[model samples]
Target: MGLFITFEGPEGSGKSTQARLLYERLQRLGYPVILTREPGGTRIGELIRRILVDLRHTEMAPTTETLLFSAARAQLVSELVRPYLKTGGIVLCDRYADSTFAYQGYGLGRDLEELQSITTVATGGLMPDLTFYLDLDVEMGLQRKRSARDRLPEPASAAAAFTPHPEWNRLDARDLAYHQRVATGFAELMRRDPDRWRCFVANQPVDLLAEQIFTQVEPMLARIVRLENPR
Candidate 1:
């Protein structure tokens, strides 16, 4: 069977960059690999991505936003992920269900059970074999991005007519209390899924962080090679 690895973190945690590095390393080692991301990775998913990420759609509801994310993920899995995994390709995903749980369930204050149910249905029981959770302070995470870029609607000007922000993005503009809740929620997630998910401090330099990740990944790679070369 193929390996499905996902990188998860708040915006600016460097998950995307690390995911690319891992993909490149695996490719150089002669492993067949597919690199993709959620809210995208398929034609239908790409269309949904625009709806989900556009800063102009500030009126989008929480439930509606969650459903759209689920929809895009369903299409991505059915159209691209499964096919590649069947051929023994290492699938490196930039964000997955964890983002929904952190951003929607915890950050947006949605029902956690409901979010999990919808995600399970969307993914068709497809879970990552391994996940790396890049941990960073919320302020640092935001600093890494310089500005809101992860599907957050731009904050309205003070003089404009009142408009409610979508729940997912509302978290982005929240006070320290809400962001603290998000951080706690992610820590709890890591605690609950320790076997499948590994939490790494993202405060280190990029090269050092990459080395730490490779230390974990190298063993898995060796095991895979052994399996393939079994006498």
Candidate 2:
């Protein structure tokens, strides 16, 4: 299997930016790579993303949100991620199952075990080879998101306009306590699987952070190449 790397973080933590930077760096280095985002990578996933993030969907329940996200994720993995990995091309995802664990399970107070079972079925047990968690203060992250929403025009949909950052969604409007729980949830997740996760303080300069990530990833890719093509 090829490399499967994922980016995870709280709102405004710059995960998407770092993921995009890594994707470009890998491409410039002549690696076969694809960068995709959660809830909206595939055609079907994009449709699901609309419902999950629409600012008007105020009545949507936590369970409903979980199911919608899982549906989109399942479509993405089946149609794009798994197939790409089978071909030995790197797949860089902006988020994955871990988001569900952090957002729905922890932020919204859903059952983690239940979310895990649902996620397994949704993803067919697929997991990332490495996950980058961009850490930032919960309030700072949320504030950044709010500022972006104030400044950036809202795209018609996730796949419509290629904005630098995503428009603020319904989840961005959640209470501070909920977001705090989500941050805590991410911490607990990293603690559970330290080897697979690389946590970075996200407030660093963008170029510096991207270099840090690429430094770690480049060595791993070298190791994989060596193992596959032993002398």
Candidate 3:
């Protein structure tokens, strides 16, 4: 089977950057790969993303939020991710079921068991073969996010964030405690699955972190390549 990888982290933790760099590196090697993000991959997922991220949706209940994300995940796994993986194509996702565990389950104080049940229904029990978690202090990550937002041509308000990138939604505007819980939750998740989850400090230089990530990914990718075309 093709490699299924996902990146996870707090906001501004550079998950997207590392994922993109790795994707490019794989492409240069002539690997068949597809890079995608959760809550929005297919047409139905994008529409669900609009509701999940819009700042005006402050009235959104935690249950409602979880369900919306699950709905989008169901579509993505069934539509794009599953087919690609079955065909022996690498699929790197920005975020996946883990986010639901971190955000709604841990960050929002929901039941992890219940979340897992929902996630099973969403992704049809598909799990990432490798998950990279960009570790960063909650406050530092938030600061980075704020600074980056401030640098944007458009003002980095709730409205602007949601409009431009749906993932950069009202969550960024949430309370510090909420984000702290997410960071802590991530640690717990990684701890539970040391074999599958690789944690890296996010405060380091991009190239350095990418190198570290590449170090971890290289052997695995090599194995996949070797297995697919055995001598």
Residue pairs of candidate 3 with colliding backbone atoms: none
* Candidate 2 stretches greater than 4 Å from native: 153-165, 223-231
TM-score of each: 0.84, 0.91, 0.92
Candidate 2, residue 58: how far the Cα is off, in Å: 0.8
The lDDT leader among the candidates is 2
lDDT by residue (tens digit), candidate 2, 1-231: 889999999989999899999988887767778999988999999888878887777899888999999999999999999998888888999999999999999998899999999999999999998999999998999888888777966678976543233557778878999999999999999999999999999999999999889987987686333223322
Report backbone clashes per prediction. Answer: 0, 0, 0
Q: After superposition, which runs of candidate 3 have C-alpha atoms over 4 Å from their true positions? A: 155-168, 223-231
lDDT of 1: 0.79
Which scores higher on lDDT, 1 or 3?
3
Estimate the TM-score for candidate 1: 0.84
Order of the predicted models by TM-score, top scorer first: 3, 2, 1
Quote the lDDT for 104 in model 2: 97
lDDT of 3 by residue, 1-231 (tens): 888999999998998899999988887777778899888989999898878878778899999999999999999999999998888878999999999999998899999999999999888899999999998998888888888766657655865544735235687888999998988888899989999999888999999999999898888776455224322
